[model samples]
Target: MKSILDTVARWLPGTPEIAMVLGSGLGAVVDEFTDLSVLPMSDIPGFPTISVSGHAGNILFGACSGKNVLAFQGRIHMYEGHSWTEASLPAHIAAECGARILLSTNAAGGINPLLDPGDLMLIRDLVVPFPLPRRWYVPDSPAPVARTGFTGFLIDQKLADDARDVAAESGLPLRQGTYAFVSGPTYETRAEIRFLRRSGADAVGMSTLPEILTARKCGLRTIAVSAITNVASTVPEILTHEDVKDQARLLLPRFSRLLREIISNL
Candidate 1:
């Protein structure tokens, strides 16, 4: 991991203040960058390639709203036949690249009644029922402490606040709620969605948890935003991967605007 980090470090134009992981069909956000340099994830040792359609599988370094940013156009997932290390590598690389703020985005099914397809939800917290990988790291603080393990992490408060303010100014209705993660290659059944909502999940998705946990271990402040791609059986509609990608198109304009403003504010 250290050697791979060193290799990638030599390619960066400057230390990135903010890092982003884009999910599903949301890779269009990278197009908003200026002076961009893109490296395929396959070229980066220890980084896994993305097989999913909407994921571009590249690391992008560019300027957004006058802020230097690093972005992962796609992310690997545990459900994609990968282990913990494969899925969590992006967060580790972001920290080594000197990004203090990690912003992750995903396309999810809305469980909250008021949320419909194309709505944006800023994650307040998350619920992941499966066992999470344990990661250890030493911090760079003046009084550095020994390497410590992380558990039960939450999104960074100031980052989330910035997202809320951006949403308000853009005239986008932002929903704040807890996200639920499941190990999935299959879409959740109606019964499963019902159970998740009963347990206080406002939105549900497969990715994000491992990356979020990994970010915490590296001492990076993190925040996640979800684009509600479907209502998750709350309505009579059947779900399909095609439908998720289609809905993400509807989300692009607002999601891009919110992200642009957040970068400017930061």
Candidate 2:
């Protein structure tokens, strides 16, 4: 089996400054990349295979505004039945390949009544709310997700401020919030949503938390953004994966705008 570095080196010609993970319908963020070189996630020695619908499940090496970028088109979720080791590989691999920054995006259901569908949010913090701790993996170690604790710090404040500024300038506004990370292939129940809200969570999602933890652990500055695809209410609403994807897709122009500006600024 090839080492993670070897696998990345074989596909990427240059060290990427930014490593981005796209979620759900947000994979369209890569549509603007020029000089694209594709590497499927399945080709990676130990990365988790994507099992969800509406996720591209590939890694892309390309230039965005003359800056070398490594992008994961879709992410591996814990809900997909992946272990911590496999779930943490994307950030581990990106950092090992010399990426200085990790930018993660996800589609979340709004727990805060103020958030609306198609709203872009800059995640100020994350809540894993479970009794068990989140694990962090070392980038160069044999056991990628070998570590056992999470850092109190997750989002890079400076970068997040930059993102907010960029969004403001681009006319794609960003709402600031705490994201609730759940281990779920299922949408949150009404009671669970209430619990998250009481815990100060403004948005809720199934991915991004592990990757952000892994990124920060690897010494890469991290920034996380979420597109509010649905609003969670006490009254249950029938939400499907397609609804989440469609809402996210509708935010493309705005999401992509802030994304491009963020890259250029970085």
- Which digits, one per residue and each the tens of the lDDT, describe model 2 over residues 1-266? 24765887787877899999999999988989998888887787866679888789888989897788999998888666666656767788888889999999999999899998888899998887754334433353333222345546689999889888877887777899999887777788888888889999999998887788878878999998999999986435689999999988899888888889888887
lDDT of 1 at 2: 80
- Give the Å shift of residue 177 in candidate 1: 0.6
Q: Which stretches of candidate 1 lie over 4 Å from their true place?
A: 130-153, 235-238
Q: Give the TM-score of candidate 1.
A: 0.89
Between which residue pairs do clashes occur in model 1? none
Distance from true position, residue 47, model 1, in Å? 2.7
Candidate 1's error at 42, in angstroms? 1.8
